[model samples]
Target: MTIQKIIRLLGRFFRPISLKWRLVWRLVVLQVILLTLMIFILLGGLTIAGVIPDNYEGRAIDVIRNTITKDGSGNLMLKQGPLLAELRKEVPNLWFIAKDEHGHELSEGTVPPEFKHITEALDYIGDARFVAEPGGSRTTATVQWAEDTAAGKVQIFTGAQGEFHIMALVSVTPELFLEIILPVGGVMAVATLLVIPLVVRSAFRGLRQAAVLAERIDIDERGVRLPVERIPSEIAPLVRAVNGALDRLDKGYERHKRFLIDAAHELRTPVAILNTRITSLPPTPERARLLQDTARLSTLTDQLLDIQRLGRQAQQFTRFDLVAVARGVVVDLAPMAFAAGYEMSFEPARGELFANGDRTAVERAITNLVQNAIEHGGNAGRITIAVNSPATIEVSDEGDGVPAAEREKIFEPFYRLRPRGHGAGLGLNLVHEIMQIHGGRIELAGSDRKGACFRLVFAQA
Candidate 1:
């Protein structure tokens, strides 16, 4: 092969997917290949054992039977002495034995050593083969019976001609190497090579997901979310964490943009009032009234800015003690509550009560709920604030209840249930936004002439 092609092949074989899975894939593939090779070797050994006969005494038995069988007159004789000698010359490694019907040895030559047992066994009965590696020559022997039918029931010591044959076994070593070991080893090597790549390729699929995510991501793109659903369960948590971080980043950017827009809008009222006062006649009552209006507008703008900042800070955390913050907010707003001719009451929690939230943001959220109660509450109306654990903040007012149709819509931004001249509609809407940002929620409870109750729920911390 060309040097370039060889280099490329080497690169493909050696390079791993990623640091973590690369080692894992290598280990898995190595185990599979090693197991396969071990099985192959075991099968090879069994096959060789089968091919090289464990016992070859049967061939020697056949030779004895063919030579010692009776003729027409039932006389047992060497079928041909010359032929027997030639056979002996041909199979140099064999051992032979001959015996008559009376159990007398007629002839014996080159008999395998273990066949001595066969000779002793023949004294009692029939023909048999025996495995005998005499003097460690590694051979087998066969012994067969011969009878003189013409001399029925022969007396003791009568000699009968008979023949015994032994055939030496051929060495099977060369064939075993070619037919078993070499071929099995080659097949095992090929199988191991093929399987390693497939295993490595399968494991690398997860790494490919991370790579694809990194490739597709763009800083400007808030619309795209990582596909945590498609990731493997083992990696799903990491994907979720990354998606969560991205979600926070997107929310932060949105908050920054909204802060700019809302600040401009809130500042416009005061700036416009100041502009009108400056353009009016000097030291007049109208100018004084305009300046006074400007101050109120400025205060409102400051509160709106504080609300925005507070909500932004709360957006990232899903944990805080809502009861504690609520208590603080109630005390802070006590003076305003008294001036509004509203009786405000709060039940202090006996134990730690928690909500998923930002403390400042949740405080502002409670402030809005109470303010809405005060503004809509009739003269001498009572407002109650209470905290119920595992998550609940209730604000109720003894004033006109919200209409059924307007209850849901009241939380929408800039959508006031009252007339167009009513105060900023963002009060409850901001509360809704705060709850959403903290991963909690706000809902309007049932109301009658007894008044409206709004409940804020914080999820388990």
Candidate 2:
């Protein structure tokens, strides 16, 4: 299929679709929100990791200063490695680098080559006897130790005139990255992964129920409502709105049905009176007049009944021969055509002119259509009725065609195409009702010829 065709097909599926689509959009929104939150959290963690190491190293450097002492010759001495060794106790995993006045290495520990630059940078700023520069992989931090023998660390030992330079690099181990951050991230990811689907599933559960309920509700079954109690609290208001709409539809259907029944009942009295008066009269001019009125009244009554019945039986239809049904109605109404001084023709539709519909109802609907044409259509015109295919039926009258603008309104109840002096205008309305019941629609064709053509197209199952 072409892209346009595919889009049209999908558009049909999405058109007026209810809660499920909204829920799907909501799920996407939630995923975006969760992802944003995760990004913020990871950035915060990295920042904290950077800050903690600097604080830890500063404290370690302070402890190292306090650990060394001065000799009688004013030369610095390690009274005991205890002060330096205490780092192994304080921060169990430690790396240290110390230098004397001549830029000589005094001690080496667990600090990696990556950390050396950081230590030198630190010393340049502190103007201390020793400087520490840090280096490592981009994600990991390391410190490099350098001595500022003239200042900070060396100046602090001026009391004894001893030159002492010590620097250290201390870092949380790779184990800390594994144990702390990895496990935390893993836990968060697993929790998020597990909860997100459930949250999304739970969020959409009400929409699913709404969809199922909507599917079960046909035009005939308007009163059915979805259960609101089991739905999530957040969706309850929406459910209530849907149920309210269904309630209104049910009420409207009932009102329309009652109105049709009442109208049909009221019309039946005048029709019955006309028939009785016709039978009572002697075989004279009065009797003929009564009979003609009775026939017209009877036809009007049948059309009204057909309209009512179409509405009531809308839900009940089965596969049937549409051509056979149309043909039968044409034969039945043929006599009326002859009496009206018009010619009636039926085009025998080829192949299986089968449609899913009520056979009796289709016949009655067609009969009303044909009879209307014969009555209102000019005396010399031809009335043609045909079931052209499994999906379509056409009825055309070669009289002055209905005006283009009025064609659609002609299907409305009691809307006459001609002036008020003509036949009762219920024929097209009744046809419209019947077509609606059969899940089909009727259209007024634009013909170049001077005639009106009505086409009924049934929807495919």
Candidate 3:
């Protein structure tokens, strides 16, 4: 495949994995590559410098024997040669000194001031060698060894009876650091890098749980909280702040619900009294108009109360025939449709369509849809309530269809296409809320006929 297509395919394959895990894996892969490169560079440098021979110990002994000789005076000395001069030029930071069996300096070279006491330097180097090779004997001659010292790094070679001895001290210069210390440090750093992602993932486990809890929360889950313990200190403040905001919202929502309930209760008594008084009045057109207005006002107040009640209470879902409920609502409102000069019809689905929802709320939602159709269906036109399989109810009117722009806004509280006199505008909003509580939705659908269609979709029982 093409490069771009291959990349796209890879992206799709990895997309199901969470971002955190993807990032962690990427970091691990990068660290592995960097560590491999570092190790390669370190090995290449040591090989080029002749520090890591095929047999390091044997090569060291060979080099020492070749460089040192016993003079006629029985003193150890470095032989003069092009090889020695070349070695000195290549590693200028290094010092070579030969010492007798008594640890007296014999070779011609300046040791660092720190090692002016030859016996102490020997003791220090011997101690370092013992640590590196614990079972090796220090008194053995013809032995060659390398060790770190206070002055730098030293390689020592000795002959029997101190017939000849040689010390090669390599200073801790920048080049030496690159040759030894940098490689060792890089290996340690790579080990640390390999472990970091695991540590980070472990630390973020609690935060991930908090995120999941937050995702499940909505208006209904007002007092729910994310776990605080085990959460990292860096993220604890944000969780606390979110919980505090939820607390404030719950209190404010409770107050709004209380106001709606109280207002509805207070208005019910006056509206009842007004109805009674209106019935006793002399029959007249004006009296009839006032009664109609009062009835509309009472309906509006009841809808507001239903909105608050639904918000405060949880759904009591049970399996019930949705077609039956739709038929009943249509029957109840059929007379109202006739009175308003509209033809109301219920087209029931052929088979039983059971759904899981509160029956009362479902009936109420259907009632609102029918009433809305009657109000807006225009004089003497048909309003159809159709119940279909999987528990779907569609209510359509033979009036002017809702404009595309106004359909969404029509569901908002107190929103109307016309003026305030047409409706208090809580009917559709209450219907929407009830459907939402049922885990269903009410959608404005396109009607094949010349009218508006509203679909109420419900989950199958």
Best by lDDT: 3
How high is the lDDT of residue 153 in model 3?
Answer: 32
Error of 3 at 42 (Å): 19
* Candidate 3 lDDT, 1-461, residue by residue in tens: 89999999999987787656666667756765665566556655654444432233233334444666555765556677776665555444444444444443444344444344443456445422211222442222222333322222334633211111112222223554577556765675576566766787888899989999999788765677888897999889998999898888889989988988999999999998998899899999989988988898799889988888784244556788988888889888889899999987788776668888788888999999998888887766899999987679999988887887897698999887777555688889999999888888999986455888999998777
lDDT of 3: 0.70
Query: Any idea what lDDT model 2 has?
Result: 0.64
For model 2, residues 1-461, the per-residue Cα lDDT tens digits are 89999999999987984455455556555655565456445544654544322343555555545654445655455546765566555555555555444343334345445444555554444333333333531223323332433322431211011111112121443554466646665565666566666776877677787789889888655668988866888878988998898899889987987887788789888889768867886799878876877776776776777666665454677888777887888888888788888888888668457777788877767776777677667877789987775578788888888876886688888777666434577888877877877778888788586777778888754
Residue 61 lDDT (model 2): 53
Q: What is the descending lDDT order?
A: 3, 2, 1
**Over the stretch 306-346, how does candidate 1's per-residue lDDT look in tens digits?**
54554334347756677778888789877887898988899
Clashes of each: 2, 32, 0
Candidate 3 regions exceeding 4 Å error are 1-194, 311-315, 447-449
Question: What's the ranking of the predictions by TM-score, best on top?
Answer: 3, 2, 1
Question: Stretches of candidate 2 above 4 Å error?
Answer: 1-146, 149-198, 208-221, 227-230, 248-252, 278-300, 311-320, 350-354, 458-461
TM-score of each: 0.42, 0.57, 0.65
Give the root-mean-square deviation of each candidate in angstroms. Answer: 14.9, 12.1, 10.6
| Candidate 1 residue runs with Cα over 4 Å from true position | 1-320, 349-351, 420-422
